[model samples]
Target: MPLPGQQSPLMIHWEASPEKQMDCQQKGKNNKTECFNHVRFLQRLNSTHLYACGTYAFHPLCAAIDANRFMLPSHFEEGKEKCPYDPARGYTGLIVDGGLYTATRYEFRSLPDIRRNLHQRPLKTEESPLHWLNDAEFVASVLVRESRDSPVGDDDKIYYFFTERAGEETTSFFDKSHVARVARVARVCKSDVGGKKILQRKWTSFMKARLVCYIPYYEVLRSVCSLDGGGWASTVFYAAFTLSAQWRTMEASAVCRYSISAVQRAFEGPYMEYQDSTRKWARYDGAVPEPRPGSCITDHSRRKGYNSSQDLPNSVLDFVKLHPLMFEEVKPAGGEPLLVKKSVAYSRLAVDRVQALDGRSYDVLFMGTGDGWLHKAVVVGSGIHIVEEVQVFRDLQPVESLVISHAQRSLYVGAASGIVQVPLATCARYTSCYDCILARDPYCAWDGRACRATATMDSTGLVQDIQSGNKGCRSISGRGSLPWKNRTVLQGDDVLLPCDQRSNLARAVWLLNGSEVLGMGQDRLRVGVDGLLVTDTLPQHSGEYRCYGEERGLQTLLAAYSLTVLPEIPRSPTAATPPHAASQAANDMKVAYISAIVTLVVLCAVLSTILLYMSCLEKRKGKYVLGEPRPSSVELQTVSANCLRKGHREEEEEEEELTYPDGCLRIIPGEAPTAATSPIKELPVAVPPLPPPLPAELTNGMGALPNVLRKMNGNSYMLLQQQEEPLVSPLYSASFTEELSKILEKRKHTQLVEKLDESSV
Candidate 1:
């Protein structure tokens, strides 16, 4: 694709073979998109030629392009080892010294493989044992050129950075033992060839070590950028790492720097070996062979009669073959991440060394986010300050690649859609010195007049601060506060006071009447991303509002507003209704209200009256209603009333008269009934002997007899002689009563004789 203001984009028609395209379409379920040629890598092989590879449908293809003409050669080479067969799989390749070094999946299975092509004898990693790589995702590759003049002789190295699943050799927690995402840095000596006898066509100087970022677990490599710092001692690798998606709930990213010396030390450490008995990984305690296994063919090796890999002893090669993993990990330069950002997934990174107007150099990092934003940050001392954020793509898409062009002074961002060329220095965007200084951009400075790019102007009289911007640019601190705009808003209406911040590092704070507004969860007031919102404005809301941006303990007023909340206007009576009409309406309302109240009261009274009537009827029924078998109305003249005998009492010589009133037998307040005055005497029925003993049910039935019998014998009186044969009728017939009275009289006569005898005794 063409850059901005460049020539029209030159197109090259590259397609897969007919057979390959047909197979891919069939295998991918007729997905024509996947059948097209997808470019995987493009590396400058030389000044005149470029090496490019692609996933041509199901087949991989490679070709050399003319750099000047931007044309591909007619003939193509097999890209089996140089490119990935699966376009979605991660792979990295680099052309160093006319040799292509690649870490990729060579076949359809997506097995991890690292190889060096374009050599007399093409070489690759071990295919068996599978300990070198496990589901590896290649991120980047670089060639670190060694200093030929060093006293401790060292050979050039090709380092490959990738993330892979942890193997059984990892000593992490049980849950992470097999599936932990481990960031790894593997290096091979440039002069290394295959072993002589033990291993052939495999790297003899291959050694891999873990890359520890901030956390000790879940380190996944996202992107890597290599910076050449004059010598091997100064060279460093900046890597972006993120937690595995399966291990984190929120997205996070960190930038960690690895120095070359630290990596070398890790490689020189003891090897990690798996113990079958313990089923754990531990440092190897066995003695290492001389000339040190996995060491480059340096001057020391040359002096040990091992100048080349072919001359090394089989013992050394065998040891190197078994122990390729180092015990120590290559931690970050500062033993921690340079910067960690939450809710952001960094996809690509490009670092540029910027010479600022302050006569110092700073490393500016261009980090691409998954949300299609480019974050520019400067490394100052022990911290990183985010200078600005630029929207690279309108749609939210992960940035696939980032390229920095020092000559064009631009950053090229590549996504799934297209590439965007962003200028490295966006100085004119800063309108004032305060903004420019607050940005802390190493590429931009205030040239005593306007904010300008340091690369495009002279540094004399220019102000720039790569460190804390407030400390270096103290003269520009006393800038005038923003003019407060008067805002007149009616009560109950909402008011919005806007404030825009250019730097993401600055925290936006809203202050009302010289007090900080902490209305995070309040309903009446709120703090939005870009402004302060006063909802349902009242008299208390009338105050001076100011938005200040604070960064590194320095505060700058960005926006201000003088808010005046006026009372809500009341509707006029004339506008609402005429006075006479209003009076009539009020009278009607009052009458309607009184009518409703009277109706409610009347309804309640009626309901209460009905309830009272029902209660009275229920009481009358309970008082007068009889259960079953209605009683017979027998005259009292037929029944004889008598008192029950008291064994302890002396015999009564005289009995009181019993009176029958209203067909009910009544006795004097203290009177006993005698058989001679009984009504049974008047009845013509003959007397009978006493009957058998009555059942309990018969005794219970006799309780419903007339009150005359009940009043005799003390309310439930009974004749003692006939007590054993009590009456059994709910109401007695005249004949039955006569019979009962006759039996009772006979028993009474016998009882009287017994009583007389007892008295005489």
Candidate 2:
């Protein structure tokens, strides 16, 4: 066949020798010649197969042979030809410049076929799919970069660094506009296929200026790197890079200067270094001269070439090795780029770095592996030096997640089987106390000693004892043991002191007044099954108490209690006396005094009145004279003659007549009437004693008695007569009869009788 632009005619022929003769001899039978011939034919084909890029060969060997082979155009079409080995399987390769290339065993497909099969139409209300990346197998990493032109705007771009089994691929597109400053970037899984997922992006705002420059780098083996920076004067810069392989690697660095805006367009001059000998900033013009063939660098400096420590000069090598480019510079006006923060590595296979949200850098790197093991390392200059590794679980189970609360200094590890946690400080030294051993703790266990939880000592008994100043003590004793002892007792009531004991048949003795009270034969005291039973509690019983029991041949005081039995109040004497009895006695004495005074007054008045009346009567009695003479003149002459005869007849009877001046009747006496014979001759009637003077009738009879009788003695003389009655006094009379009545009346009328006797005297 003639070539498109060639001129030589080519002729080919096959020469058969021993191998050809054996190949023909084995046409119908199997032999050593046939086998040798077949083996030679296969070898020839294998050599030709090894030359083609489609051959299954080692990477280094295949790469050397077809290093400059242009990609095939048919690999980009959506048909069986796109995937020559497996027509049914979807293509996964790279489409670059106008052709498709396979770097591994994967096939290839055009961008159009992927769009139709994987990409869905955008909702009417949603924004358009400005950036999209399908084919999960080809996507090894994704990163987002903020534009510096709109520092405060939400314009952010996404760069997808992918690698197929066959070749490396890259695609960049706008993700969202108006992204916030200091935004937090993360990847979330898409919710469609079980294993097929995509990245979901979100951000937070914390800074005044937006991120201006962001870039990502990766290798064909799926290693990833990133850098980002933004600021007013482009003075501050931060960068992060990572390489993911069998053993992962990470590098993070930062740099700052007074001003990055003063640099020129082409050369900002080589970065300076503080040489120890000179003690000054020395210009190092050959630091990172250029990125290598398979590498790229983006920054304010225009040196775009492969980067390697060997290729860089000493001055430039030290600058790049010590203070690498932290962030790429974005030239808005082609002047100095603005300042931003460090870029973060984004990879599907790389583990996310744990950082303190408080902006404090980590002194140690703590990584939780898919297998239930915790790897700890310290941060060195540019690498992590692993110090310890602990198998957190017996089985090699994957760890689901991890949570660290810095305030509590707690670390929680969530695993596929269960959850475990421990204090980070304690666990840092890998000591026995790192884990909790108490059986009751749900979230912790005892590695060997002490009580520990996720971040605290959840043992209630221990915590309570510690807080009460009995840190190492087992039980809370002292006042807390008997909660009811510090109590009050009411007067005249009994109180029980609880003495709880666990042992049966334990002899407990209570002491009072330095003597044992239990079994003392005292009726007031008793020993019950629990404690001492006090019958009557008195004020004297209130004192120190001790309960002792014999344990292991020694007297043990189990508890002590103070009992205060209050005193009973006394009753008032006055209130106890009966009111009615006292009042009656007082009334009786008053009546006696009143009666005596009235009686005495009446007696004195009666005596005085009686004495005056007696005096008057005596005087009137003297004035009255006996007038016998008038009758005598006429009787004397007749008496003389009778007297002579009376003497002779002395012994004979004699008659005599007596006459008063006021009376006409007369009695003649014979002689002197002989004492024996005159019988009779009423001796001149010794004139009957003149009648006692009659009392005058009371004129004012209001309080005096009425007159009893009236009599006329002579012509004009009037006398009020006193009626002589029974010998008994009328005042004492009950109709003036009965001796018993007289005595009773005398007692009843004693006052009146006494008055009358005084008047008579």
Candidate 3:
């Protein structure tokens, strides 16, 4: 897709050849999902064209697309070695000087190889039992221009990042889960060609070293984002890593930064040789070859009568083929990760260098999570502070790719749904100087009026403190304040004050008068998700309530409210009443007292008469008991049988209502259960059994008793008649329903849990 200024976006759809699609379908591949064109590699070839390739239904194809028209030609080149046949494979490539350098799986069952294509004579890594690449997953590739102003006039180099498994002997149960796989950084000279004779059509300047991070149990590389400093000596790369599958039980990830000079030194160190007898890799201490086996063709090498790799001697080429691994491991710059996060797995990374108002360039990292969130952070001296987080996708899909545009100040995010364009300079979200400063974002600054983008405005009045966030903003005038909202309520009534925070990194703190409220309380005061709720309002609570946003110990007022509690008026009569009114009131009270005594005496007499009659009746009929009557054997047997039938019917209904193959729980009110619709159904209940039959002796012998009295005395019929519906289990009613509600809430702004203890809900 192309977005031309003031014009509709243009989209060019590419389809696979019908013959290839049919072949893939016949081989047991899914026709709807697998046998389709999926573009995997796209890079700019020149000013007006782009080099692109795709998995054309298992037959790889490449084409040259016109940049202006966004269309491709009919003819395409065979991309068997340059692109992978499977779109799901890990492939990384770059186009430098019209030559494509790629690391990909060339065939269906062959090992992955790194090759240089589109050259006069294509060259690739040697296929040997030493296993140069063993189950490797490529992450990224970058070209470092070292030919400009080089002290030794060294050739340009292309670097590749990946993670691969170790040798077979070192993959025991204890080692495989901890140290079986290690991240690698490999490089090759751009001007290198095939060797003379020993290793024809193969690279002679290939060398790889281990990339080490200080994080424990996180050695696998997931993604890499590089920053070019206009010189190879100053370039740096930021990589994200996670734990291996066997040790991965929590959502934890880390980002480490490495310098190019550190990686270069590792490549120049000792070589690691694989010993056949021991089946292990160790540092080589053998004879050294002239011109150093894996060294690039520099001025000193040219002076030794070797102008190109093809002119190298047989001895040097043989040494290069045997020892391609470096001994020294390249460690990260601070001996620690730039940031280690828990409960979030970062999948993609992008860095943007911004020149702040203070004239210092800062690298702002944009990290994408597996659950469709984007975290923006800035480097502050030796530490990092997260500015904010934004949800880029409505669905919880992993972020696939990220691209940053410096000219437009926007970041492009790619996921399963589609592409999302987010602005890099969202300074307007920070309303106060303290919030803007505490954020430490280089692209934003406080301009004495409001937080604004530093790129578009000048630095005359802009204030930014990227290192130390404390800029004495506690007394700053008009610091993100709102007008007081007057609220009047009667005594003992509850009141709510509204305050909404936009940043998840900051916590909202409520202040009564001038002192801060202690914690989110439950008695008479508390902080809810919407705002501050105060119950049982009194005159003491009638004061100014201000909500301040605090982050990293800095505070900024967000909202304010004024409350007034009115006292109740008296309703009793005063002393200025007339004499006639008092006399009337006294006479009324005396008559009321006499009526109450008469009523009490009449009710007491009725109770005594009833008690005497019940005693006399019990004595007359010796068979009648005072407590509840017992059921006969016939009634007990009938109730038990009915309960057993009801249990069976409930089990069958439960089976029908709980059929979910995809592990997603869905319930809809007033909807019937079906395979294609909802899965909630009300289990049928057995009707109350008819009243138990009267005892035969009571009906036949009690002729003097009334008809209603005889039936009531025969059995406890009321106990069987009263029946209510059963309550649903809390596991299905509350927990599962809450999960379904969260699924629906994802369409809006998804709430993220912060690491702070005092953050507002």
Candidate 4:
């Protein structure tokens, strides 16, 4: 028998040989080789049930037996014995937290009896006599595995699922018991032993519905493997089957997936409830009420208005309608039950099928069937095409498990007999050679004769050369066969070296020292694929080139190419330099030098132009001119005053003088002279006399002018001397003064002004 860690029975033949093993050890010690074992097979045991003395393994048998043992007794003692719910029937028969536990029908029936019995006598078990579950409640049935569905959890609780037995008249008569009813999965802890007889918490019912009608009737939940090294937690996938009563009718099946997060929510509380607004006792919330320790209520009157905390909302009750696999309805050719790959297989194997380390996608599938057959399939457009099917066993025993060794490119199949190894590439048509080589995967290349690396000989040599260069400073020289052909060429003949552009240039050299090459120098020797050209091949130009290059940073030499000058050269001697070639070369050199100098001069000129343009721009934008004096404030003020005086004189001249209506000068007419007796030519005085007595209305408020006039009324001689001077006419132009006499004669009030003047005198 193979040990738990040993590779299964079939892969034993693929083990390494003693010599190869010794070589591997020696290589490891010497550090000469990086050993990669491509072929590896591992067999991992399903020891999840071994904990708790394999209680999960024994639960089914125990439940089956317990059902029979308690069936008749429970029926007989019905109301008299008050049979408690069976606790053992609810055992989940799953490996949880590294232990195996179970709930059975007998345990559910005996729960109440056990609680009562606990008060009288201590409950004891072989494993631990003082073990007792704490804060436990029996919500609903936790057992009854109809579709081989197991719900596993880390907490010390087990759940049993059962459905109400349907009436015989219903279509789903046999499936009556398939309806799902969940209960709190619990276990007695060793620490909580002998503390309390009654549990603090009570089991609360959440969702309950007929089983056959629900889309996904069964689900198996397993722990999710953590890539971050966290311990396993629950992730669930379900397989459901829908059957029809008609004979030979095809049954549809699907694999459904559910996230762990969804299940945790469903288990938190009851999912449906009925609230009565009128009565407080009838109104029940969805919380699990505290359990009364030792009290047993037997009266119907007291329980009539009693509210139970097991009511749930209708929203969570609809979870049964959500099916994860909505499209997996078609059946394969085989009439086998639909099998869902485990979560681990989906995460590791299926994911690895598509993604290789080279960042390329592979359309491959490795299907390990229960019938000891390994089926290889590749994903084509929209469908999967089966490539090969290999039967590793003669008998039709199912393959218990399967694993892929990516390092080796091998598949390990575990069966009842043992384990077997199959090369993955051998089943594919294109041989998967490139992938194997590029990946440097463990599986070696087999070419019908021997196994070797799939890399080309040249590529291998190149890689080896690279490695060799890294080891020391030695140069790599071209080997035995030149790997090139020699050619003798005539004048003007072109030679080509079919080398990649990435190839070393220094490795190529020609022996032209003997030839009188005019422009030959270390820098002037142009190297390219078109082999070295010595125009006008002279007789002395025939030689070989021991090309040199740096390989992996070290200077190295390449193969030599021999050249012989042909006697039959071109008739025109076209290989010789042109007649103007020297002049052209000199002109080109001169042009290049001139261009450099011109560029420098142009650059300087451009800079100078820029500076001059900037200076001109600044001047235009308003920079001060040199040697120009600015106007002073005193000068500005004097100019402004002169302008104001000129404006005032013009304004005064423009004003028209007011004349008396009589058109006569009223200036002291009695004392001086009338217009008719004016002195000499009677020249008009540029002024007019002020006459006329002040109106009483005008002098009504003026006491000074009235008093002066009253005093003057008594003395004419004094009044004549006291009379005011005449007012002047501002409108009369100096040139128009001669025309004033004719204007004064046109008025009739001239005499009144004379009389008023005489009265004043």
**Model 1: residues >4 Å from true position, as ranges?**
1-9, 28-30, 168-178, 472-484, 490-494, 508-529, 533-545, 553-555, 567-761
Please, what is the whole-model Cα lDDT of each candidate in the order they appear? 0.73, 0.32, 0.74, 0.31
TM-score of each model, in listed order? 0.71, 0.20, 0.70, 0.26
Summarize candidate 3's per-residue lDDT along 189-249 as a digit string, tens digits. 9999888787788888999998978543345788998898556788999998876666557
Weakest ten-residue segment in model 4 by summed lDDT = 220-229
lDDT (Cα, tens digit) per residue for candidate 4, span 1-761: 88999964531122224554465456442212222222111111133211111111111111111222222121111111111122122222332332222322223223321121112222321111111221122222222121123232122223322222221122332344453221122223211122221221222221222222123223221111111112223322222222323213333322222323333333333322222343111212333332221111113312443232222222311221111111112122232322333211211112123432223343455555445666554433333434455787777675554566777766787666787887665512323222112222212233432334333222222111111222311223323334444657675454543322223223343434323332236432445554554455544556655444333333333445666767664445566776698666654333333233333443344345544654654565555232224233211000112333444465488743322211222222233333333232232223223233223222122111111111234323221111222322232222223322322332223322212333343
- Which has the better lDDT: candidate 3, or candidate 4? 3
Q: Which residue pairs collide in model 1, if any?
A: 713-717
* CA deviation > 4 Å runs, candidate 2: 1-154, 157-163, 166-360, 368-371, 397-761
Clashes (N, CA, C under 3 Å) per candidate: 1, 35, 0, 56
Question: Model 3's lDDT to the true fold?
Answer: 0.74
For residues 1-761, write the lDDT of model 2, one tens digit per residue: 67799865532222224553464445542333222211000101122221122211101101112123322222211222222222222223322222222211133232311211112310000011211122222221222333345333322222222322111111343222321112111121111111111111111100011112233222212122222333333321221223223113543221111122321121223333334675333444443543311111223222433121223233432233232211222222323212221222211121222232222233343455545777544332333334345677678775544556667665677665787774554432322221111111223323334444433443334321111111232322212232224434656565665566423324666765446565748766666667776666766667767776542222335677777776776658765655676665544333223233333343344445544544554575443323232233221111222333443354245533432311222233344423233222222322222223222212221121212122223323232322344333222223323533333333343333212222221
RMSD of each: 22.4, 47.9, 19.9, 38.1
Point out the worst 10-residue segment of candidate 3 by lDDT.
702-711
Q: Give the 10-residue window scoring lowest on summed lDDT in candidate 1.
A: 702-711
Best candidate according to lDDT: 3
Please report how far candidate 4 places residue 416 from its true position, in Å: 5.7
Off by over 4 Å in 4: 1-98, 102-195, 198-247, 251-253, 269-355, 358-761
Ranked by TM-score, top first: 1, 3, 4, 2
Tens digit of per-residue lDDT, candidate 1, span 1-761: 77899999677888877888888877862455677789998889899988899999868899999988899898999988788878888888888788888998878875688898898656778756536787788999888888456677888889999987764354435365335778899998887778777668888888898898976556579999978756666788899988776665778899988889899899988898867798656789899998889888878888878878889998888888778888998998778888998888899999988777767778889999999999999888766888888888999999999999888988889999999899988899888767888888888888766899887767788887667686544553333567779999999999888888756667777777887565687668788778888888999889888787777666677888899999998879867787789876765433333333333343344345544644564575443222233234321122322322221122243332222211122221213244333332122222222223222222212211111221122223222222324543323345446543543443333322212222221
